[model samples]
Target: MDPLLSLFDPQVDSDSEDIIITETRSATLLSQNGSLPPECEEGNIEYKLKLINPSKTRFEHLVTQMKWRLREGHGEAIYEIGVEDKGLLIGLSQEEVNASLETLYLMADKLGATITILRERIITNDEDNCKARKYTDHRPHKCRKAVEVLVRKVPDDQQTIELRIAVLGNVETGKSTLLGVLTQGETDNGRGSARLNLFRHRHEIQTGRTSSISKEILGFDNKGVPITYNVCRTPEEICEMSSKLLTFIDLGGHQKYLKTTVFGLIAMHGHYAVLVISSIGGVFAGTAREHLGLALALEVPVIVVVNKIDITDNRSLTQTLIQLETLLKSPVCKKIPVRVETEDDVFTYASRLTTDHIIPIFTVSCVSGYGLNLLYKFLYVLPPSVSVNDRQRLIDSKVEFQIDETFQVPEVGLVVSGLLISGLIREGDYLKIGPFDCGLFSPVQVSSLQRHKVASRSVRAAESATLALMSYNNDIDLEKSVRKGMVLIEINDNSYGHKICQYFQARIHVLFHVSMLCPGFQTTIYIGNVRQTAVVVAIMGKKYVSTNESASVMFRFIKQPEYIKNGSRLLFREGPSKGIGHIVQVFPIITKTNDNSL
Candidate 1:
């Protein structure tokens, strides 16, 4: 076993670890110098050409900075000891390296963080000339050796850091099979026996095609090793024992279920997207390309998975990879393809994924379990990309929960499940659910909350959970009143009066269209979890908007009013026509009522 492999890599090491990179324009702060980009003030990645013995005050300041980096990364930080602040890979001497590592470990101990030397790199000066390739670090002559390390400490306020990744690809691309192998501790039998447990519908089981959204969770312990059924008897036990949770939203890949796929991408609020491309079936099948386009339009970062390598011939696999790489490099995607082939590559790319526009592509087989270890290591180290300030704002904002599914449990009353858009919620909290037929909200009490089938003390911002609800005053018929696409929010006032929107304005860019889009054009509109049919009422400064054009358009929902918010991402589509926008303003239809509407 290699010393560089961390506990989560391939084989387990007793040692514990990216300074997490955020997905924002923060990287623009860097200035390119030669080939290395200078370090920025923000983000979890810190570059130190060398960390040697420093004064007492200097060491304290270094510790403080590491603390902030950990917070920004939601408890993870990356320290490149041999890298310069300006991104130069200058290796230090063996004596200097040891001293530098001592300083780093001390700094981590001050903040209760765990540290691990992730991997090492050898840098050679141009002066080394022809012998650079033959030089080794032990010689300590004409060569520089650098080391990369990972620092980790779980946040104090939360037990686990949660991340949502949406799985998308064409039908029969082995999406479910890959997820099943990852979540369950089992390999396939070359007959797709692994994916059978993930099917949600009778037709899907009969046809082996997913037609609805299904969810599977992968848990990792604090040291970053995966926790599966082998370690825990049940998922509830896994949730309790793990420190990081990844929720994979599995969506339908067939064209007939495109709407369902869109709803999951928008409503689930996924932080990352896994675009699966089958090596044998090739890239152009079912809705593979369309799924990629949707993920791009929604601004979700993507990781491409090339599955079914065990069954594909080398020539076919090469051709499929070339085609997939070409599609990724297209103007619309404009993403660089980074192939993950080793443990070192996995650690390097995963730590920088959120900050870079490069997409990590993996080749894996469910039956043989080839390349799965590398993928797991990459995912285990990946952190949530949302910045700290943005997360705080969402937590401080008013509570709003979007309903994606409704169910009737025998023991429990009405059970509504979805993502919590903002604010915090606890059991027994009173919230408002509605904008019903006549446009009014009714009071409802949260009886209990369950996250991943485990009883939750509370659910906070950006977390998904199912809440058991009981009608306040028992006046509303829970089953008849609650449905999908509605919201549950907290009302601070006694005023029963509420308003829903029938009209809204958005700045949109037309991606594709059969013809010019003009007034009275009807399309399916998706914003968060709310899906409705809306007709374009007017286009400002233009009579009609065509493909590749941008405009401000006003739309009115045809069927009913919806509770909406300003600045939400909006997508509209009809047949093959697709356009994306954000709500700039909303026109509310105020519904004044002393009670709930049915």
Candidate 2:
């Protein structure tokens, strides 16, 4: 047995908060020498000491069992060969291991899946154990080995899997450049040449800083090979050829554009966040820390990228890494920092990124392309935070599409691009879009749909698309009726109409407030894609609140009544004062009528 296996505690509670408990348990099980039946499995993992030979019926049963395990893990499963079900690592001979792998491949073939070997270790016993061996050979024999394999089923419905990653950091941290390098497959010239294509406006190019939210894509095929502009020449081509798509939300890092960054993070529904830090400059600047805090508060899984490695010296790089590790390990973050130096580290971390505690740090230089391949591999294997069942539940629920950007094309009429937070939206579906100054949703037809610049018939929950809207019933001007922060919801004839209101109550945590938060204290509030000024009307159960305090507060929008949902995340900020909370209750609007009798 491996010495590491001796430290394993089989009786430890599986529900512990430690994210790596699963991996540890797997390791411990693989090092044991006992065997148990497959029916005794308790988790997504399964063990097989060896499968060199099996009856036809047994093989079929094993395939069926693997199918069930795959379903439990949502199309992903792990298999430990040369390990017994009783958590024993009974190593297999080289021939036995080869035959077992071939059998596993056959099983995967039956389920239309692919397998990747994660690790292989040789188990060697000491001479004292060899002396007690009952083998025919008198010489001390080397023990057998074990292998850990990951089996991933190719999604049959959608050709490609989508993962949105919000890229955030402080100014000059190379967020845009890193994205450009990843998506365009071109190294930077060290003078902002790579980021030129990602810039939206002339001002951004002139200043060499992103001031608004931009997006770029990097695609990976089923085999985990990147399909960038170098191979496809266009995004549409990449989408057509790739089996997985990674959407990078390139957000501004400047303090002035912090609101835009926050909106991108919230509205985009990013599965993970990639925070870039400069090795030379370090994270001493408060903006980097602020960005990290925002991601943490939102509960977004983060992967830190220490950039500018080609330009920085060893001392500077080491110092920057130390600072980042300290922050991640601090009480506020409490993240387990794993420095990714090899492809193995990437695979291990990517498979476990959903735990929200493992923070994988990567060191890369856009100019020299150091560690870029490892980053791409990591992204290729990173599973989405949301599962298929969750998405299905949203699809079954009422449709709620939050508008993030509105545009009036020359001939296309009005097009609103946003995410479908719930339910399904088809091209011909008629929905109510609103909360204009009049505080009501008007009927509109979905004339067309486009995702990733490719025309599509429909969009599903958690998917982003631009929907062209046409006036229905009322002769509504879409440009005037639709606005950012508004929602397009499916109409239900049976229920009381959707509520719109200006006043709402929220339980807020004052993350940081320079002064006491009293009644009438106003700040810019952001809920989803909606950004509006709101004033605190009342503070419940408290005279006043300040930093690190919590209170239930009544807030009224300064403008019109906005369509807000219950339990929606709300972020309010004024200068350095920032607070994050969620809507707890909403008050309905009451209209007064003219009374002739009075």
Candidate 3:
């Protein structure tokens, strides 16, 4: 095993003498007696013999290198003191070690970070010889020690870290129950009592199944403690108290509501997906495999959860795990399944979840409250996939908000809920929202903004919120003009040429088509939050296409023109056929015709 991989291993004793060291060495660290390693390498881990008494230039260079390593590890890095470039344990004296640690603190201070000593182990003369022993005869002949320190930077922004997770699996897999237990801070009564609060409609409560997309939140403070109804009274309080928030998009698990589930997975921009499997039923009943395939196709990282473990025996649980492992390792889903059994497993798996192939499997029972703490810890440590650079770009770009759902409240006249895809939006800002019947945008004012039911003055990019809109045109009816899939864009000083399109060309790859796809085939296409029926008017270079085939197709919406952008991901489905593609070209609607005959 790689020595760095074992850094978080729970079984390894930090103070033991039998410490495992890798053959890899850092070329940047200066060695006393030996030369630098043959290959220079820089990564999350760095080695240093000691940092006591360095020149001014050398100190600046060291600080810069530390900053690079911290960024490489996503705001975290590990340093090994009293080690040479060739993995040699050249132990330092007690005085030298203290000075080295003090220098590390200085470096961290300069970099706006905090340092924590993870471990320390002493080395005697028998195990490894110190090169400085030959020169220092007046020092005491005591064992010298090496220290491992972790440096983490404080997040720059004050806004809470938000991560959207889509919860999906087959029906009756305890999806709602697990989320209820997680967010409500209450265990199940074994009769589906915990999930009652999450249901939206009477039909869902009566049938004990979710048919619509619902949302729940799990908040964690800076110290990683969960803040739920036990401590907070409302979602606003939870948001205000949390430093990190996990928005759970609870989607339906049945095949009948597959469209709604697909929309939730695609439109919500989920960073990760949690696939719940019932221990008694094992797998492959209704939509387990389908949900898994959809997640993979959409390029969403997945974590597996085996629910209702309190009812299953050991043998059955083992069997279920075996079956899941086989499916995950299959060709269709090439994922490395790591069963999380301890806190160490949670830390290791959460750190590597962005790798796309590592799938962590967790088993828990909401009724018995087994293995739920580990799950919560994993979520608390899970990092958002959106990079700092990407977020900055979004903030610098023009404002674009995709409308997902709209409402006409009694007090709040016209309210629209959706995601802010780019730029920032503040209360009382004037913007244009449209693509009405005439395919034109209309000016509107943002009366107010609410996020997670908490009223806020402003909402930034990649955050979900509801904006109460006031139409500037008193003659127009807001309810008749505004609809789902419309966008609210900020009107700049040079805004021009923004119109909706009825026809567009896209490059599509059919995932699976029962029959050949030809021209005039009608299907429901979902792009962002837009769901409309479109017919294939032309196939660029082919007469017909089949499963796993690629082609360029021209589609015309059956209804009015919709506002769509180029390079947007689109999913079209009809019956058992489904395809995923992106919009490559858009043709604007031409409403005016000149009379040439006159």
Quote each prediction's TM-score.
0.88, 0.88, 0.82
- What overall lDDT goes with each candidate model? 0.80, 0.78, 0.79
Question: What's the lDDT for candidate 1?
Answer: 0.80
**What global local distance difference test value does model 2 have?**
0.78
lDDT of 3 by residue, 421-522 (tens): 998999999988877766767788999999998889998888899999988777578877789888888765223233368999999988776679999999
> Native-vs-model 3 lDDT?
0.79
The parts of candidate 2 lying over 4 Å away from their true place are 1-44, 127-143, 493-498, 591-598
Tens digit of lDDT per residue, candidate 1, span 1-598?
A: 2111121122221212122222322221121221246776888888887778889999999999999888778788888776667766566677877899999999999897888777766565555333433323445355466777788886665667789999999899988889889998789998888888889988988888989999998998767788876678777988888778899999999989999999999999999999998998887666877888788778788999999999989999999887776656544356777788988777867866866788889999999999998998888889777656677789898888999999999989799999998889999998888877667777888999999878887998888999999886466687987788898888563332333688889999887776799999999999988898999999999999987789999999998788887888999878878888899988767656444443
For model 2 the local lDDT of residue 388 reads 62
Looking at model 2, residue 291 earns an lDDT score of 83
Against the true structure, candidate 3 reaches a TM-score of 0.82
**How many residue pairs clash (N, CA or C atoms closer than 3 angstroms) in each of the candidate models, in the order given?**
3, 5, 0
Question: Could you tell me the TM-score of candidate 2?
Answer: 0.88
